[model samples]
Target: MKITFTLDTIDKAAEEILSQCQYKTLLFYGEMGAGKTTLIKSLTKALGITQTTGSPTFGIVNIYEGNGETIHHFDMYRLKKEEEAFDIGFEEYLTSPYWNFIEWPEKVSSLLPTNTTKINLKILDHTTRLCTIDNGSNELK
Candidate 1:
């Protein structure tokens, strides 16, 4: 599914994304300042998370709990190599039955599961963005 949204409509965009996703793992792809983290914050809220959420850039990952579900958010932008993911037990997290939201997933592309969903965001202006979600199908649906 594809959506065009502004900060004012981000919540609705997040809900639409959740409804269209086919897997628990979501890989976010976007350039710097493209609103990846902003969208994630909206998504976490949609998933019933009441706490504030932010990019895990320095921490690598952040674990959030809400609505009887555990969410693992990862930021791979700082990794010098993909092997670094192993050092963090990323594989173990991937195998879990919880939700996973990964930023800079291209850094660990080979490790991603085939069933994962990919959300690509593009900045259209200062406050507008175009979001294209693909269900790991190569072609956007």
Candidate 2:
């Protein structure tokens, strides 16, 4: 599903994304300042996460608890190579039942599951942004 929303309506947009996304593993794609973390904050809130959400840019991954489940949020931007993922046990996380939210997934593209959900964000203006959420099949339904 695709949505165009402003900051004021971001909560609603987050709800729409949750309704459309079918996978627990999600890949977020966008350029810097495109609101990837902003949208994720809304999404985690929708999932019942109560703590303050922050980007995992430095730590690589941050774990959040919500709805009696664990969410693994990853930022692979700083990794010099895909092998760094394995150094950090990326495979173990991928095989777990918890929700996985990956930013800059292209950095570990070779290791991503085929069924992952892909969310693309585009900055249209200072206040408006467009999002397209699709299953990794390359078909947006």
Candidate 3:
């Protein structure tokens, strides 16, 4: 689905994404400075995650604990090899109940589930972002 929103309305759109998204795990695809981190931070706040959420580019994955299912914010922007993720049991996280938000998912397409929701982000301006989420449909190809 594709939609347009004002720059300041990112949080609102994020909430809508959380509510309407069929899959708990979302893969964010975009180039550098595409607002992937911003989208995910908004999603975490919508989920009531109070802790500071930053890019997991260096640490690989950042985990946030919640009363219900936890949130796994993963950034593969700095990933040099897929084996680094594999060594950290990334596969286990994929199958877990916690909601996962992955940035730079193109780096691990082979490991991602077929049902994984793919979000494509494009920077329309410094404040505006155009996003489209693919629901694992052949139409995406």
* CA-only RMSD, every prediction: 1.6, 1.8, 1.7
Query: How much is the lDDT of residue 137 in candidate 1?
Result: 51
Top TM-score prediction, candidate number: 1
lDDT of 3 by residue, 18-45 (tens): 7768888898987898888988888898
Write candidate 2's Cα lDDT for 1-141 as tens digits: 789999899999999998888888989999999999998898899889998889999999999996797889999999999999998799999999998999999899888888888999999999999998888652323
Residue-wise lDDT of candidate 1 within 8-118, one digit each (tens)? 999999999999999999999999999999999999999999987888999999999988878999999999999999988999999999999999988997888888899
Q: Which segments of model 3 are wrong by more than 4 Å?
A: 137-140
Write the number of the candidate with greater lDDT, choosing between 2 and 3.
Answer: 2
Q: Considering every candidate listed, which one attains the maximal lDDT? A: 1
lDDT at position 41, candidate 1:
94
**lDDT values of the candidates?**
0.92, 0.89, 0.82
RMSD of 1: 1.6
Each candidate's TM vs. the true structure? 0.95, 0.94, 0.92
What is the full ranking by TM-score, best candidate first?
A: 1, 2, 3
**Cα error of candidate 3 at position 20, Å:** 2.2
